[model samples]
Target chain A: MANTEQVKLLGFWASPFARRVEWALKLKGVDYEYIEEDIFNKSSLLMELNPVHKKVPVLVHGRKVIAESFVILEFIDETWKQCPLMPQDPYERAKTRFWAKFAEEKILDGAWIAMCSLGEEKEKAIKLAVEAIEKIEGELKGKHFFGGENIGYLDIAMGWMSYWLPVWEEVGSMKIVNPLQFPATTSWMNKFLDHPVIKENLPPRDKMIIYFQNRSTELASRPHDWFRT
Target chain B: MANTEQVKLLGFWASPFARRVEWALKLKGVDYEYIEEDIFNKSSLLMELNPVHKKVPVLVHGRKVIAESFVILEFIDETWKQCPLMPQDPYERAKTRFWAKFAEEKILDGAWIAMCSLGEEKEKAIKLAVEAIEKIEGELKGKHFFGGENIGYLDIAMGWMSYWLPVWEEVGSMKIVNPLQFPATTSWMNKFLDHPVIKENLPPRDKMIIYFQNRSTELASRPHDWFRT
Candidate 1:
């Protein structure tokens, strides 16, 4: 069943948040116009669409606009229920959402700080980031995906591990996601990347490294400015 | 219409996160046993129930346990369909979640810091907190509640403003939510307090002042320890 509704996504190429939404849209086989956003020098359309956060990924479905990636993902799932993102069971759904929140609030922030800082600050960040990774590993519990058999909300929310974590690890010169340590998460990362939709959507690893390396250099000089970006 | 499942809430009396969940239970008229935990000296049950965060406001429904107040609110809304906390429309639900998240990530932390710190740091915290309040005021837009007609998820998430903001203001010696500056928020605050469930749930103002005063004193001495508690 082809969707006739006009769907557009304003996103930056490197944003893990944007990538999560892209994966969801693709998995559901929904066609959308993807607009590349310059996050550093944001577009007027981006500003007009998401005046509150003024950030991507912003989803515009016809006249209605939605900001925040998790919100956008839920909106997409609800609007196009062809491939359900959230579980039907309320308890299971709540568990999925809890981990999704954890990915955003706890995991991403720590990874960002770890990748950006240097010296003792960097060491502290690494410890915190690893602790978060261990928590994710605990959640995995030998499951193929966070959603058991298929990729779901928690899987999409944690999509960053496959692409971004590697770069962050390389840039920070740290190893938080090794198969030796977190076997379940490491395996999940591989499986997540191997998924056709996710595989196709992710940017090249070599390119990501270069981009992150340059970004990391800038962040190292201004470590305290982690929250601004 | 009675719930036969065993429902219990592990919470701290002073925590706003815990309060939000408590209010949701009260509003839903769900019979639940409220267990006040000593957060400073973690209860074994609290640690076991919420091994990841080991934090307050853990909701136990039958055999299932849910942590994080926002997650619990969603769970409660889903489990008990009557007197729904979230909007039925997906867009509206997303908007509610967005603001709820903003309240947690931006508003509460700023308020905590502002009320805790002294001198220059306090001024900066106050600025950030006021900015967040101004944003909420914009969202209010002449509404009685964040949910427009009813006290919904966003309202519950921001319930802290009604109880905690005044205490914080008194401790910080700053006025962020006055009728002159944030008329809409000020009005909403009053309306929130007037709600029977909310009115009944909140702690005594005098006791709150004493608790917050002691907290502020401790935070002032160890400004960097803000995130720990």
Candidate 2:
């Protein structure tokens, strides 16, 4: 995989978004060179390629730069032709992509809500967190995976919530996903983390806790500041 | 087009999400029977079709139902090959989808920040609004449409922001994309609204002003009670 077809990933190992590409690539068994990026210490390569987002988990297929984790996943799906991320049927594919979006936008961002809220806002955050979980459970009911049996796009898109959110809770000193209240999500998170493909590729829990702890601190310190280089 | 595909759209005229599909349909010249639904008083059919979200801009193509506005746009791109909504290049398509997500999560959500923020949070909302415009302005600098020249996925993704945001501002009596501050975004919004395909598909500005005024009053009056609904 060189010249125009080279598959190289710019990522920080502990990132859930990076983990998303790792799981997909590993599952698909695609050979890609993983370049570790310390996002805080910005690299010229990362800066040039993803000048817009300037975030990691940018997949470079040949010369084409595809930013956005979910977007990269789609490109990977189409390019690799292994471990299909989406269902084959147009309607089913639409359904999977919908939940993929829900996971990214709501469940992941719900962590921000939990972390940011104070007193009364905390209660609202908790309620929204529960709602986010309940929505996922409804989507997951009677299906082994969000894609039903095989782990598909929704599962991969939401894969972070399964593996990383708990680490976020541990580091941020906030407990949003109470197992007692959200047993389905709790169990699913564990089950997903334990799944062999995911387990082998899983970033070390301790490192993630440290990374996300620093991240939460940094974000809270400057809630409005979009990353300054 | 009529008998071949059972294309029916459940939408509220005022909703930007619904408008995404309306514009996509109009751009592709796809004939679809549009059913007007009151968002709060959503019909049983809309609920039955989109049980999970139970939200509008649900596209029913034959018996298959596609929910979420972006998902629907993708579906439309797939179903009707009249005009390709996405890029032919896989990487370009991925980039298009990337900006679309950014538009939904960051750009439009920025508008909501202005809508929802009050007291201390209001300042942060203003910052987010500024960031939103700055980001979009940067994205639109050289490109005629977000997809360049052609109104593609990004244009459809952000279709609502062009008209509805101004309407929302008029209702709330505030300005987010100030002409002097973000001249590029201001001009981009103007160019966007002027596009013939978009111009024809927009909800009547007069009605949208009324709708947004009432909606703004509803939100402003019960600012803290947003979670109750």
Candidate 3:
């Protein structure tokens, strides 16, 4: 049933959000046609398919188009029953989702601020980013992964920290996720990235560093309040 | 089994997030203790339970505690296994989740800005809020509710708009979800509020207006960038 339906993913190469969908689909062993979107000049198809946000990582499943990476990840999990990303138990699943939302709402935004801002703003953002990472570190204690030996929904949801955090750190010439501060998260990031599916699918690190370096410069040139939204 | 478990809800009276959990619990016919929190002065228990966000809508089911309104709603639905908030079909469920996320991310923020800001910022926020509401209006076209015939997950997720939007509009002396601009959403709001379960569980309207009025004043007096976070 899963094989018969057409599945297409609109993604940008360097987008951690897009990478999440790709990793989920790959883990599920679901066949999908990946369309690389130029985010700078979004394709008409991408805009048409996801008219609301017009963001990448839009999953076109048959006639239905699902936008938002987390939504897409859940769709992929529910649609393809193999390699379940979410936990089986309701309690565990709730715990997993709590952390996932925390990552999306706090860590992601804090990390973005940490990378993009300069001086005092950067200092405040770095503090926020580190605090968020430390919480994840506490959650990861005595666990191989957020899914406990399996790279499940929460791990995939927080997967960006494994790859992009390092890129952001290097590009900004600053550090957030370090061994002393976040030992468990550091260990979890290593295991998460070292996983076969995740290892092979990541964007080239050097290229990502260059991309973010340019993005930081571009953002810095804008008005002080430009990135407030 | 659900009846056997001790269920307690830690919530604030005026919080739409906390109200969501209450509605879900009542709909499920699950008996639970409701503990009201003074959001102004944080309780040690609330802080202990939801240390990360330190926010409301914390559901303590026996020993297991779940925070985040959306996460708690899903947990309640799964744990009770009756009066299902989510759809049975996967695609429909994905759509429900998508709109829920959309409401939380876009409409909530835009409306908050619209309700709280003044002068140019207020005008810009009104535009953004209206645009977000218009998108929901389009989605609600030809449907009695976002959940189709039943007031389901999306409807509940968006329940705040029915009550709070009006309050915000009256308090701010502005409009966003009017019949002329958002006919479908206006109609859906009527049906949603008319639903017995939702009507019974909502925070009182008069109290909410006063609450937001004071809140808007407090926000107005703060440093211009105070609410930026």
Candidate 4:
């Protein structure tokens, strides 16, 4: 089965989205070659595969090119039958999808929050992050996973939070998730980190902190003048 | 089965997204109650069904609520079972999904392009609108519909190009689709607009123009003074 299929992953080490594709492929026991992308000088082929978004974690198999991290997640689940990332029941699948989207729209939507924004911009970003995290905490009630009892699709979609977000919060010098406020979620976070498949695949925490700190500095020093070629 | 199950559609009158839901229902011969939304004063139930996005074109059938216009179109086809929207072949299905997603992402991503943007902003918006249209035009290639000969899932998803975008272009004072540049798509536009189901159910074009114009005005006049609100 592996011999006939040519699977390749194009990614950068520091990207949380790239980490998602890596985790899913590993869980599914799919074998593929990894090609690292320079975070700053992204390759031309990467641009070709994803012309519209032109961003990576692009998964290419045989002649098929799939972009958009969320869409790529779905395609992997569909194309590879071995490890089912989503549930069999369509309703549960819908619910899982809803949370995956909620997690994305909430957490990552505020990535710009703690960036170069200062004072009031910084303040609004913090409030938005707090509100988003509070909403997530509410969704975590009575569930070990976003899909009750076991880690599921939403888990893979939100794999970054247990690791990367803490790093970002540290760099920004603002706390988004509080254990006291999100006790259930905090416990769930520990379980997510403890899972065998995820735990083995997790990135080095110290390295991520250094990466984001450098990124924050670069963002802060961006020129005030805007130009288009 | 259709009579036994209650299907209701929640939408806004002037929205192209709402039109997609209407076309899908009519194609499937699934009778549904259409509830119009005041975009400014969205109802509480609409809020509950779509708590995350809090935006409409929601499909409620029996006890299930589906948001995201693309997902709802697929659900309507599956739930009704009278008319099929997606192609049987997986590759063809993937292509259809890609085009549908392309139309949606570009249009939705460019939502803020229409606001308080003049001179360079208008040029930027037109460039964006043209790029989006050209991609859709490129995909038309040798197919009658975005999904080939039959009007299927992707076409319903791209339904906006025929009815809604013209309204938007009129109100925004810009021309998006260049028929001369895209002959295949130009012909499809005529067929799609003339389809009885689409033609009969569309909100009058002049009314939609007025609706969006007023909304645009309201958004423009708001004091974006960055007042630390």
Q: Best-fitting candidate, measured by DockQ?
A: 3
> lDDT score, residue B209, model 4?
76
TM-score of candidate 3 relative to the true fold:
0.96
| lDDT of candidate 2 over B39-152, digit per residue (tens) | 777788877988767788899888788898888998888877777888877777887888777777665765665665466565666577677667777778766777677788
Task: Extract clashing residue pairs from model 3.
Answer: none
- Scanning candidate 3 chain B in windows of ten residues, the lowest lDDT window is B220-229
At residue A193, candidate 3 shows an lDDT of 88
State the interface C-alpha RMSD of candidate 2.
Answer: 1.5
Per model, how much of the real contact set is kept? 0.83, 0.86, 0.86, 0.00
Q: Per-residue lDDT of B30-134 in model 4, one digit per residue for the tens?
A: 778988887678799888988867788888887888887776776666566676888865445666766677776565435335433456666776677677877
User: What stretches of model 4 exceed 4 Å from their correct place?
Assistant: A1-3, A221-229, B1-4, B88-94, B108-112, B221-229
Candidate 1 residues lying further than 4 Å off, grouped into runs, are: A1-3, A227-229, B1-3, B221-229
Q: Residues A114-193, candidate 4, lDDT per residue (tens digit)?
A: 55456766777667767877877887888888757766678888878787778878888887778998897788878888
Q: How well is candidate 4 docked (DockQ)?
A: 0.35
**lDDT tens readout by residue for model 2, A110-212:** 6665564446655665566667788777666566777676777778888888767777667656777788876777777777778889988878888767766
- Consecutive 10-residue window with the lowest summed lDDT within model 1 chain B: B220-229
lDDT, candidate 1, B1-229, per-residue tens: 2247899999888888899999999998889999999888998998899998889889999999999888899999999988898998888888888888887767788888878888898888778878887888888987879887889999999988988888888977877676899888888988999999999998888898898888888778775465322
Q: Which is the better candidate, 1 or 2, if ranked by lDDT?
A: 1
Give all TM-scores, in the order shown. 0.95, 0.82, 0.96, 0.90
Candidates in order: C-alpha RMSD to true structure? 2.1, 4.2, 2.3, 3.9
